[model samples]
Target: MENLKKTLIKAARKAHQVFDELKDRPSSDPIKIESYTGYASQDRMFLKGRVLEDDNIMVTKSYEELKRIFYSFKRFETDEIPGVKVLLYLDDHEFQVYTDEEGFYTLDIATPDSINVKPGEWIRGYAELPDIVGDDGPVRGTIKLRVPDSEASYGVISDIDDTILQTHVTSLFQLKMMFVTLFKEASQRLAMEGMVELYQEMSTTPVGGKNPFFYVSNSPWNIYPMLVEFLKLNELPSGPVLLRDFGFGMLHQNEGYRGHKIETISHIFRAYPDMQFILFGDSGSKDADVYLNLALEFPDQIKTIYIRHLKDTKNARRVANLINQKGEVDAIIIDSTREIAADAREKGYVSEKFVLTEVEADE
Candidate 1:
């Protein structure tokens, strides 16, 4: 493992040698909108997207899609385009915002309450940046806004690593994670067994209720587009993905990792104070400790905690102990998503008949 780490570090240094020379260079090309998914809570909308150089080549269909996956890796970040104008248009209203120093912008705007934005539905909207232009004209793209059902029993806040996807966060030195991220395409990575089905069932209500799902990860925003593609490929319920910013400076920083995740999850809780949340994470990293702290802080807001047990028995016991200390919140440590699915069904969180039907169809 130490040798592998050294090799990976050498390769990264080599890549950075080239990256360093180009990092300070500026591009004259117009900026384009690279919008991530957005989610709404109550009367406010939380919007996040990046302003990047308009250098992507258009792709369509099967073969082209494969090429597009490669193009995603080569995407250029226009960090120099900070303070550019970005407009979010919903219905007849337009909310104007500016990109931050990292060329990433987030808009938290007050929107008039409306019943038209149904739960589990993607609200269609256009993001316009008139200064940014492509070959044909001004840079603009369709942005989808996801809203949770008003009658949903509870909302879901999940971690990306190990819970839904096979990221070796718990593996020795995270070698498998490095291997997969370096060589595999989003479609090539495998989803956790029965996770997609279980999530779908949990998100559905008997009266066609649609709960909201949010994915929080330690990964930086650089891979947001690829993660979105992976979620779409696996047919997982889509919601806003909150990711951190990574640059030369972030590499040496560890103080903010836990705090950033806590802040993001707190914002969601504040956004929808009346809505209960189901927390899904793994025992790999600080998830167990983080979730435990969160449940203690917002005991009423959290309905249950689901922690996927990794192979590390010591870590598992530590997490189980932490969960056991929190008597107010119902927490469980399981080796698979199927166990949670069965528990959820038995506890009236989902319909078993619907899950069986969907699984049969997929088979």
Candidate 2:
């Protein structure tokens, strides 16, 4: 009886320890969908709100639950609305959901039973409501949830002012200030040229049909919405967006960007083992340095590096040399969209068969 009592006590203590560990584990809460309404100046038609999930996970207060619930809200004018498509990504596993109604849809994600997620994980959700009759045909958005024990394949670390949009940050000291003051006027005066073509090219499937366009930007968090709108307007392929927070003490103390882009990229590479990346940036910033370091660190995972030339020819050449030293760049071509496209074609980067074609400005 004494031996049996001792065994029972040991088992009870072990069970309590396990329960305490689970209770203390971190978790994420369901993200609420926000709606909006706007107009596309090109079409001059009313654009209805199509709420989408952001690419990052929405973290909840409870950290140990190991489960996440997400709601997708979509609305259209008529019953014949195109079906809503939802993409849920947890680590390397991706789940797709389709909704037939013009209302709300929900999903429940539970952690894998085998693993006890320690610090929790990030789960991202994306939604698209394309082709609504009597309204603009396209509506797109995304949502995110954080779960326990899950891991992301890759993290997007990006530069904001130029790579994602048309902002010339190097020339303008306070670029975001300039944007806030001039974006509306600029949107009215200047039409986006070649944007659609560039987007189409980037959105197409790669050689092995791998999805490789993740975003990492130097821009601060305050202007994420503006950048997102700009990308959507251009019909560009969207991915995870990482923004720096200027308000953080690091920026004030370091006199440099708050987020160490190279370090972030390195961390992301470690987190997502199966993920490979195509690095995109402009010559206006330290993207060359950051990407060069990344290539050196993760030579196998980095497929190609595309840098937009926003600097003088001499400066651009110097940056090119840095990338060349990295040894992983498949090719480095400097020019606008047309010239880059031509070079890409010549190198068999654009297509399997090299076909010489004229690069025209896309409308």
Candidate 3:
């Protein structure tokens, strides 16, 4: 493992070197702050975004879908702006942050103790590059942060690759995964059969409110924009999307190296201690083991777990053994959305209308 990590680091350094050499030293290009949806507690706010020299590639092509695949490669070949100080404004408060070597900035700062928010409400803010100017003022990034409602029953923490989106993470060399992730546009990408409806149903609360959904994926942050667009196009319930850093930065994080999903979900759980969660993953990854063990540790907070069956016998058997070992939490393998909906109905996690409306349709 140590040797393999060293090799990956060396390769990453080379890639970074290549990117640095290819970019123009001083150009008239515009710099922009690309922000993602953030989540917050009453007393603290957690946020992240990137500073990059905008490529100015036209991403939208209503007529030609394949053009996006060509542009996605350019997004991966990012023109990062590093060591730049950024200013973030939340209401009347101000916070200062700086971009890392990868042009990514992460903020976990204290909010005013007097701040009050109802769970499920979104707080709006903005991030600005102090040095970058626009027609009126500095170029800014609009930020939205979600505050979980204590009144809600549970939130969802789901895997993106196979559980929701149809990225074949199990394919040889992950070639199929790369093809779908890179070559396909957001509209061209496929969500699993019935997953769209299932997730939509899952988001509907009994009081007609929407429960929160957090997406935890091992996908690098470079594809954050692509994934966000994919969710919007597919109409999946959007929340804070916690993706890993790419290249050398990924290897340095101790917890992230152990399991990105695990570390990310644990942080979410800690953030909303009173809120229960319905865990979702696929059998293709180590999701079963990670989620199952988490259920043991936070048995009270985890309502149940659903593992999307991918026909991996060895992994399935291993998950089965773990499930048997800790039968306190309800964990099951499901081959279809219909199965999950049926189980969820029995447990009162979802509405009767959801199962009746979702399962009665074609698979």
Q: Relative to the true structure, how large is the alpha-carbon lDDT of every model?
A: 0.75, 0.46, 0.80
TM-score of each: 0.81, 0.50, 0.89
What tens-digit string does per-residue lDDT give for candidate 1 at 1-363?
989966876776667557656765766665678888887755667878887766653322343555755655564343435778988887667778888656777877665675256655677788988777677787897787788787788899999978888887777788998766544567777787788888887887788878889999888777776678889889998888888876533333454565667878987887788889888998887787888788777888988889988776578788878877877678888876667877888888887554432332123
Global local distance difference test of model 3: 0.80
- Considering lDDT, which of the candidate structures 2 and 3 is the better prediction for this target? 3
Error of 2 at 184 (Å): 3.7
Of candidate 1, the 10-residue stretch with the lowest lDDT total is 354-363
Model 3 misplacement above 4 A: 1-24, 57-66, 134-136, 254-257, 356-363
The all-Cα superposition gives candidate 1 an RMSD in Å to the true structure of: 6.0
Candidate 2 lDDT by residue in tens digits, 168-283: 55564656546432333223222224434554554454532323344567664334454556656555655445554332123123445334587557655654555566666777
Q: Please identify which of the two predictions, 1 or 2, would achieve the higher lDDT against the true structure.
A: 1
lDDT (Cα, 0-100) at 327 in candidate 1 = 74
Show model 1 residue runs off by greater than 4 Å: 1-30, 55-80, 112-120, 248-258, 352-363
Sort order, lDDT high to low: 3, 1, 2
Can you write out model 3's per-residue Cα lDDT over 1-363, one digit (the tens) per residue? 989978988888888778777774887778888898889887667889998888865433443546665687776887788888999887767889998878889888666775555577887789998887967688898998899766567899999998888898878787998988876766677788788888888887888878889999888887787788889888999888889877556645664355777777877887777789998998888888889778767787898889887766676677767766766678888888889988998888888766534442245
Candidate 3 residue 89 C-alpha distance from true site, Å: 0.5
